[model samples]
Target: MGRGYLTKEMKILVTGGAGFIGSSFVRCFMEKRQNPVVTLDSLTYAGNMANLEAVLGLPRHTFVKGDICDPSAVDFAMKGVGAVVHFAAETHVDRSIDDSGIFLRTNVVGTGVLLDAARRHNVKKFVHVSTDEVYGAVLEGYSTEGGHLHPNSPYSASKAASDLLALSYHATYGLPVVVTRCSNNFGPYQFPEKLIPLFISNALEDKPLPVYGDGLYVRDWIYVDDHSRAVDRVLWDGRAGEVYNIGGTKDKANLEITDFILNKLGKPASLKKHVQDRPGHDRRYAMDSSKIEKELGWRAECNFEEALAQTIEWYRSNQGWWRTIKSGEYRNYYEKFFAGRLAGSSAGSVN
Candidate 1:
């Protein structure tokens, strides 16, 4: 219900635009251009309305609460949209480990529905959001765009399936599809269940900071805004039927990051609690993002230290936003995942 600067050819349909990275992209895309955006989300537990409060009532931005697997719902949102940016998926590794049915249904079947709708509706572009974890653990070198997909967890496997499904459309049916695989994203508005935000929320309340196994698991971290910009670049500049990798260029161990957070918050290192590692937890993930960097001139511009500090500050100021979520099923899940895992360990576990 708002005026927009985009023409008839620029209207975009963004699925899962209410989640962390999706919301960031929606805001960035709107701010960068006057494109009219129609966001379709299922309003799941992790999809919070507060994330889009900034642009909820803005001109040319609309929100539709619906599932991506619903063909009628997808067709409704795709009416005037020229492009589709897919961000909807069951993304949590732990949750997928617990129950993978929803992940496969949402990530695979939902993507199928979206691809069909885009093909039928003559959408100009389809940017499918994916993760670098689909490449599994990179012990030595970085994962290139064409790296073998050895997804170690249900969550990543579902995404990999979706990735292949999207590319198939481009190859078999000539759908203009582009896939983007991004590394770990940490920034403001992330759910309290993610590693960075979870540790921060627990630390604020003087709770134990759970560290998985030896805590040497390494991951490349990218700021959510930087990721959003990268996605936008792919949407506008990437070639059809190609894949791009987006990386933060900064790799840090889990233990190092948790300690840094505690130190930054003026908390003690004594809060470190080592728990049993989840099954099939990938030890490391690296990305060779040169494709996106060289092709679209999109590089992650946020420094890790600066962005981490900024994220911590945002959590400090936005207690009301996270306090509500942390007080819900997340608390129970945290207890089950961490406390339960460590309950039988000796005192050495708290080191």
Candidate 2:
């Protein structure tokens, strides 16, 4: 609720700012506030410039094409930044299953690189954006911020390590670190590999919606914009060396989400395919978000159904955006069109 820490001229360094949630935060921040932003992203398969088209050519937004694992890129992006919102990481469970090494490198070691840069640069605030999977499966009650971390998959284990490392920076060196663990995020521009987007796009194409196992694995879902707002709150007012849980207050099983998407798209149940569940799939994820609500006065503001409908409409409207990624054409398009021009340009050229 307080804006004491951020000034009008302060520039925020948002890592992974070209990705889904990061782009949402950038758009939200630009609309509500006047702070300049420097976005550092490697432009990976999931990170797309099309996702950030809204703010790409704006005067206040700067996009840097670079990886978090690169110290030079991190340092270049950290310059003159008042706050650091760390969102750069490899965040796919299936991909991690295929190759866990990249997850460890990008999530753990890359976080260390950013934290050290924040420390050396003396940034005003360092917010480490993390996930609820760090608590593994919350079978019964909610997992609080202080709950034990039981990361089952390699991706979550890497995130858990990054969370601890980010907090350790505050504990050991007083670097002003705040960590936020959020539930499943769904909204526009999400890479189709994620469950909600994947199902939506698949149903749209009249393809099979692969429902894992019995299709009953539950997760707490939050709209991406609400999660962005919560992160903005933490970036400005959160207590250092502390963790906050952010949730949507909507817990639905996998089947519920799948059925909703199929029905919403006017598709039939026969399109549902029962696939073997991935290894170590967490049964359910629930979080207690009371800390952020009570202290920061932030709560999830959007209804799940309404937000989900809006997201479906977004996909419908932006077929070219998701279709290119689905067909593997976006990579070539990106390389030929955007990547060559923006790579290491540093002027934030939108052309």
- The TM-score leader among the candidates is 2
lDDT of candidate 1 over 1-351, digit per residue (tens)? 211122444889888887899999998988888788898887678887678877877768877767889888788778878889999998899999999999999999999999999988888889999999999999999999988999999999999999999999999998889999999999988988899999998999999999999999999999999999998888887888999999999999999899989999999999999999989999999999999888899999999999999999999899878997877744454344235433341211111
Q: Given candidate 2, what's the lDDT at residue 182?
A: 95
Which pairs clash inside model 2? none
Q: What is the TM-score of each candidate against the true structure?
A: 0.91, 0.96
Looking at model 2, which ten-residue stretch has the lowest summed lDDT?
Answer: 342-351
TM-score quality measure for candidate 1:
0.91
**What's the lDDT of the predicted structure labeled candidate 2?**
0.90
Can you list the residue pairs that collide in candidate 1?
Answer: none
Q: Which whole-number lDDT from 0 to 100 does residue 78 have in model 1?
A: 85
Among these predicted structures, which one has the highest lDDT? 2
Report lDDT (Cα) of residue 156, candidate 2: 97
Per-residue CA lDDT of model 2 for 1-351, tens digit only, reads 333276768889999988999999999988999889999998889988888889878889888877788888788888899998989899999999999999999999999988888878889888899999999998999999999999999999999999999998888998889999999999999999999999999999999999999998999999999999999999888998899999999999999999888888899999999999999999999999999999999999999999999999899888999999999998887677564566454333342
Lowest summed lDDT over 10 consecutive residues: which window, candidate 1?
342-351
Superposition error at 248 for model 1 (Å): 0.5
